[model samples]
Target: MVNLIYDKSPIFLQNIFISLKGIQIYRQRYNKVYRKELKILNEENEFNLQKKRFKSFIKYTRKNSPFYSQKLSHLKKEISMSDIELLPMLTKDEIREHVDEIVTRNKGLLPMGTSGTTGKKLIIYSHPYDISRRIAYLDYFKAKHGVKKGMKRASMGGRTFVPEKQKSHIYWRHNYILNQLLFSIYHASNENIIYYIEELNRFKPQSIDGVTTVIYRIAKYINKHSIELTFKPIAIFPTAETLTVTVKSEIEKAFRCKVFDQYSSSEGAPFIVENDKGYYDICPATGYYELERIEGNIYEITVTSFYTTTTPLIRYRIGDAVELFDTLPENYTQSDIKIKRIIGRKNDYLVSNEKGKVYSAILSATVRKTEGNFIECQFIQNKMDEVIINFVIEGVNDKKTIEHSIKELMKVRFSESTEYNVRFVEELESTDGGKTRFIINNLNRELS
Candidate 1:
């Protein structure tokens, strides 16, 4: 009777009903691929196979990729896989400057625009094969948690404004297409949340993915209202932003499910995935990653994606700082490497009050503990005795407690005489299309 009523309902109402059913069918198809991927992940000798694959990719990039070939011309030596570091790390600026030259003039390649946090956008081209590989990687990760393809996926991302009538319906037609209930991050608000939640309950997706900040906001609303949300997703995948411990906890608490963090970028490949054990493991099939230290122990991440043939970003300097749990080996596999933390961008650090000094991970960790829902934080040191802490917090809190905590934390982390002032304000914004930087230091004027 319910099926007959839904089938015979008015066009407007029928569309909603169809969308909800389509989502369920999509999840089932996705789950099958997920299971197959999990088996591959657990296979022995996978690391050795990945290493062999990487070596072959390096050779391919050196020959086909003009950007890499030009850079390697100076090193008049046999280019082995180990010689990857010898190549200069590519940056976003370089890509923008040499956009046409970097991209292979080939058909069946897709172009993607990266909306950087700084409002600077970069258009990158990728081969269709590369896109398929990315899908495979997602499938592999999802399978570990028993997520199926036919299940509906709600994405809290930028592209949700498309009208229901005009938006692509191929996903709905095919159960294996991974049905997406796209919710716009740009429009997330009280009213929007209510509508989104209601629609989501109707759609009942198996999982959700997208920016951590937007997801956190929705989770906050759900928790605040103490709403008994019936749409229990199998997993929540957060990408594009720094997934702090606090945000992760809150999200998990609200959704009552495990939260998986994915570390990826437009220039390179999806590099990291959190396992059931809560440890971030490198994706063996995607690319190779290395950490290079600039000052003291502060490191910058360099990635070389094997699958990026259209515009190979060889030894790409992603500009982000990271702390590794395991030191990379001369001939290492994915299992040999683990990331302890992503320490934000290299530019998002402050100079220490101590002469001839710098701060990175320690400072970020300190500010992260302060009382606020901050999108970004920066320390501005104009003089030896004074420092201004520019921050963006979501709502009201104990300012006195926060200030005192920051001051005490800074004292212990840096020089004692460095008195501080906390600037609490809303709208600590992001680069138009990029992740927010949690820490910024203006003292390094020349560097800025």
Candidate 2:
């Protein structure tokens, strides 16, 4: 009802509402907790800081969370950094099944939703301290790349804040309180995209952040049309999806700035952000991370986020993978933060003339329902109007039933006119560096 009224309102009114909403939530995120974290961003001796937070997090989890209390009943109240290994590693399914018991607090929690890129939909709760500190880490990351506190910034997010019935070229809303322009990804069709570029030219944002593929699409259009942007941003921070080498290079070329590829989960996972020196460094202050080797230095990530106080994520396997520097101590800690590459989320997209392009962030919706049914699924797009769901089943799930479920999910992201070829494959092939890409879009061949 409120959403309906807000959507039906005029653009000017919508902007005002957006700002009001931003104002209400902005202070909560940038409060004393955030300021304190900012003050300590450059503080040295992170090993000590991590040691303190990690031990405290474990004790807190054991006492407050019913699920963890039972799981870690064997451990003493006082636990050391070395004792972390004894604690069990948590998977998405475990968290989903026991979320009620895992959660420490019942009230004063903020729900953070992930699109289930790993074929699971999850709502992670953030305590006030958790959210505030998280925002601070992100802002501190921007500070490294010359972003100021109150600088004019543009953001491209996956939210559909704009009404579908609207028929205007304008596709963004400005929050004067934060001096930020929020651009809607759903509205950035190939034709109406010019308005977004025009707004960027006029607003002159110092920095840009949001969904990677949407920003990539804008960069692609700018370069294709040879459009000269008046204002050059200091940097671009692409999140929510993977950043491919070609996409990063293209965006940097178009914007005349560096693209800082960041790695963090919507579930408030620890940060592995790109520094100004173009090196990916794991932030020790955010959380304690464990890199268990899957095969020869290529390791799977398990994070214990301090920010998830409302819903503690101790040794949570945040289903992303990475490669680390070969030279490291046997019992490595956060102080030894040497990350070579973040081969995390599937770095692929399905192109569309009407919708521009839908990347993994949005495409992940199709498989959220069929979680345990398949080992992994790959989406192959040969044309703009059709996509093939080639999946490797785990057991005896009916192919037609799974396809029907995915077909329903597809209608939400893509046009109902689009076609799908659902197939059961023996095994899906891996991409470069053994990364299993969920999307294999051959549209680039057509475009080239």
Per-residue lDDT over 337-439 for candidate 2, one digit per residue giving the tens place of the 0 to 100 score: 5877888543266776567567777676446544445556778787778888887776665676788877776764565778888888787756566755567
What is the Cα-based lDDT of residue 442 in candidate 1?
42
- Residue-level lDDT tens digits of model 1 in 1-448: 8756754555456556656665654454335544554455567355565677677776676677676677677774456556666778778788888877776546766777553433234568975556555666776678788786557788765432223333322212212234666665534434456766666677887998876766777787788899778878899998777787877888998889999887877656647878887767777667777766655444576787766768877777776776676556656644556677666544444554352233333454455545534444656556556767766555566666667877876764555666787787664434444544444444535421
Q: Give stretches of model 2 more than 4 Å off.
A: 42-44, 327-329, 344-347, 364-384, 387-413, 420-448
Q: Worst 10-residue stretch by lDDT in candidate 1? A: 167-176
What lDDT, from 0 to 1, does candidate 2 have? Answer: 0.79
Report how far off residue 398 is in candidate 1 (Å): 46
Task: Give the TM-scores of the predictions, in the order they appear.
Answer: 0.64, 0.85
Model 2 residue 174 CA deviation (Å) reads 1.1
Model 2 lDDT, residue 229, Cα: 95
